[model samples]
Target: MKHIIPYIAIILLATVIIYSNAEKERTRITERCQDTFSDAIRTEKKLLIKQFCMQYRQENSPNSLSVEDKKDWYDQNYLIATSPSRHQLDSLFRDGAHKINRNISTAIGYTFNGKNYFSGDESCRKSVIPVQECVYRKDTISTTDIALQAYIHIPFYVPLQNTYTYAVVLMASVALAVCFLYTRRRKKNMTGIPLQELPETGNVTPVIPRKVQTEKWMKLTDGYQWNPQNHMIEHAGKTVILRGEALRFFQKFIVDKHFFLSYSEICRLYHLKEETNGAKDRAYHSIKQLKDNVAELGIEIKSIRGKGYKLLFSHRNRQII
Candidate 1:
């Protein structure tokens, strides 16, 4: 669980980065399309103007129309040839331009002759380009103007279903590899012998007879004796009855010899809380009573002030048992 959290965070970070980059690319493409469409509209208008001028000149060459009349004719012809009504442009964009780039849809709008004309999807206005105003001029005289506004709508791309599956498989592989290596390392550190392959033979026990001697009593000093089986201590020919916490505390001193037993060790052995009410006082009282009980046997329990407690005894007084 601890190891999986970091991997999950990494996967999330990667997903965010991928999505951000994809959105940026989509925006860039939309902007490029808008610029291209604006140029196309300007180019188309210029062509229509040139064509109308040539036709007008040819038709009126014999009678020779006035300049104002030519300008009016040019405006009318240019508007008719180049400027489709909003409805017509909308239909064209929906059915024609939309098919050109399936990934990116487009919308077009025109302000021609002081009337607004718009075409294509209404929802695709987010990436609208600035209106490109194209003026029709002949010999330095302004005939008319048309404004083209274009919008390129690029939908965000999402990864296919296989992408998620691949990511899951990758994370699982990493987790399994880490777990396998950890288990191998742990097993390598273990100490053991295989018992299943032991040789089958008779006389597995030692053949030579050996003498075994057991001590019946353990002596702390010349006048003190301890009976392990009975759990009794005799001092100066008097048996001292010690039980429960006292007996456990005395057994620690016996086992550890002169080594200090810290207050924490004492608390753990006695199942006592170090921070409980009067816990230290209770421990001190118990030690005082134990010292009194074993005083006649030349044994003493000494406190090392803020450190711990230790049993004071001469090593030469140790019994065989």
Candidate 2:
């Protein structure tokens, strides 16, 4: 689990960066499509208004039957744009966009007087370009008195934009990050305690096991201390090393009340079978080794019949803890 942490972090970082860049690219495509749609709609609307006004001017030409009809035609056509003919405008309106926008379904529509008209998908609805007034952070799109608005949505669009510059940069950055993490971890392992500042005879020195540096030492008596890192007890310039089951039982005895150890407790510490023949003898032998080692420091172990063993300290070698 510990070794898998760096790989997990790399995956998450790549995913987030790729997702953010894809969203930015999608936004750019949507804006370009909106501009294209707006230009087509505006140009068509201008042409329709020009045709509507042309009828009025035609009445004053030589083709007109009389001057009285020309005056009446001008009056009737003055407010033609205010109450524009939907059927006439619809004739000019066309779905100017490609059927597929980069392989994603697209539709173009116009809404006027609460009625929608389009030659594409029926699901397309009117929308503001960029969606918000302050789109980037706090801006909005332009608004107009004209009721005509275009539909601009790419339904179920995939994030496979044609441009790859941003994606390339994102991949390169993630690769660098992953490489840096691996390199740093390798450097830490390479840097350990220098066995010696310099080797003799230009030879590499073999690594000797070094005691772990720690501040905690179990104080037994005023002059007796237990160096657990080395499993050695020291007293009066003498050191006694305890190992194996003896060392474990010694450590447990320090924590037990009255410095006591029962036969069953000793068997459990050494993982020996309990309540079996020779169980007491096995427990006694393990405890005897620990007792004999500490006896040099004036500590004695006394046995209680049918019970357990206890460590007894003399007045001169009273326990400090």
Candidate 3:
């Protein structure tokens, strides 16, 4: 659980960054939709106004123009601009939004005199449209008495190569690479030098090895050394750490051994009740573990039937022999 902290932190940080960027992008798209709608409407209005103006001028001469006539003309043009049907509104919005951003999708909504006159998308009829990424806008226009509103919205997206997505992916890749290298290096260190690659050991050099020992490190025989602090044995450039019960057994052995430990003595050391199979099993398992860890040193824990255990060396590893 402790080791998982850094990755968890990275994930949370990535989430925040991505969310922040998405919100910023949504806001940007909303504003862009507003701008695009205004521009398209403004441009379209200019053309419509020019076309109607020409028709009005042709129908009624400037000299004969009356207040009613001008008002009537304004009313007709306003209806044409604001009161287009659902199909027309959708086409206008879609085309207008796409002109600005080719990938964008748009829906039309309109209300006249406070009643929903036209709504394009079904979800737009309710709240947000069918799509999650969308923005809405509605504006009121007074033709004469009734209030007319033209509603439109555009929805854009964050591009694939946007800042937040790229940043998170890059960070994840780097983190994985670092973890892999760290594990590989640790594994290599623990494995040490392989025996097949080792140089052959010469005959025993008693003087040189004896000089290297301190009170805490015992040079057992010749090539094998017992490092008490580390609970390890080193022989012929190979090292092994004694683990758990094995370590405890070795510690007791170093302090109390006179070459052997009776089964009762082992039981006392481990606080196991005497005259029980548990004590014998505990002693047996621990010594077995100790024996395995020091196998490279050719040290063995020999069980004495109906008695206890003693450490022994095969003739090949006993320098004097």
Candidate 4:
């Protein structure tokens, strides 16, 4: 019984070693399966072979090119140049053997005796010229085979540790949410405040008061102050404060008590030319103010298309017509 148990253990160990080595060899074989054929006719066929070889290399790195893949490549590309006599290329496939370092003299190629299986330039050839060579690798066995190593993964069902990393992330998320809510509430609370109570920063401007004086036009020392509130010259209501110089010029040219003036004529009559920037700006402001304020005086200032402004106050049934 003891001897039988020892034998059984030995058999089991041998089986395990053999299975591991077979798996390794199969892996190596799969890797070595990548193939590339040298001579090809069509552009498409060449591209196809190149792509197939590349794909095999990518899939089975370190070692690629299997005998079957190599045979397939040759059959597919070679058919364009030469027709196959047999259904299958027996020389390339079928043999678990791989081609070694053999000089494929472009014209002659490699040869195997007795079997047409290894006859002719079994090597790759382009026309009568040898363009490239096809070299292959072989597998060799070692006496002392290594045991297969197993890789174990962490079990999904196991409980994970509560690291400070997860807790810190949770705390930061909560703080951010609270900060956003607080900011939103603050904005809502402050939106209702009136402008007067708001903080006064930046410039605090001083307010300048405008004083308007009244006088009669008859008495003149720079002409009576033009008052809109005067009773006699109800037309005074139509008067606006003009530059002291423009007012003096108007007094001199108060033609026949009612001189109709065009806006342009007024600009001309005053040798009161707007040569200076300040003078032109003031003149425009004065005229605009006169026209606007006089409109409220019940007196109509008429604009005659090609002509200009004429002032007329209504009295009796005649409107200074």
lDDT of each: 0.55, 0.53, 0.56, 0.36
C-alpha lDDT of residue 48 in model 1: 50
Using TM-score, rank the candidates from best to worst: 3, 1, 2, 4
The candidate maximizing TM-score is: 3
Worst 10 residues of 1 by lDDT: 131-140
Instruction: Score residue 158 of candidate 1 by CA lDDT.
Output: 24
Q: What shift in Å separates residue 48 of candidate 4 from its native position after superposition?
A: 66
For residues 64-167, what per-residue lDDT tens digits would candidate 2 score against the true structure? 22343343233223323444443333333224334335344343333333454454444444432321110000011112112333344554334545456466
lDDT by residue (tens digit), candidate 3, 1-321: 544676677677777877677776665555445444444444554544554532334355434333543443354347445655544435665676676557665664444344444445565655433221111112112332222233434333443337677877788778867866876687688686654555788888667554565547687656667887777777878888887667877766655434566777776764545645535544554575587577776677767888877666556754442
The better-scoring model by lDDT among 1 and 4 is 1
Ranked candidates, highest lDDT first: 3, 1, 2, 4
lDDT of 4 by residue, 1-321 (tens): 432554455456554655555455433332222111121122224443454332334455443434543454444434423433322232232121133112111121221121222223433322222221222122112221111111111122111222433454455566556656776797688797865656869987899898877564552112223332342223433344444333433333334345465545554643334343223333333443354444454434444555444544434312333
TM-score of candidate 1 against the unseen true structure: 0.34
Pairwise lDDT winner, candidates 1 and 2: 1
lDDT of 3: 0.56
Tell me the spans in candidate 3 whose CA falls farther than 4 Å from its real position: 51-77, 80-83, 86-89, 127-164, 183-321
Model 3, residue 106: what's the lDDT? 67
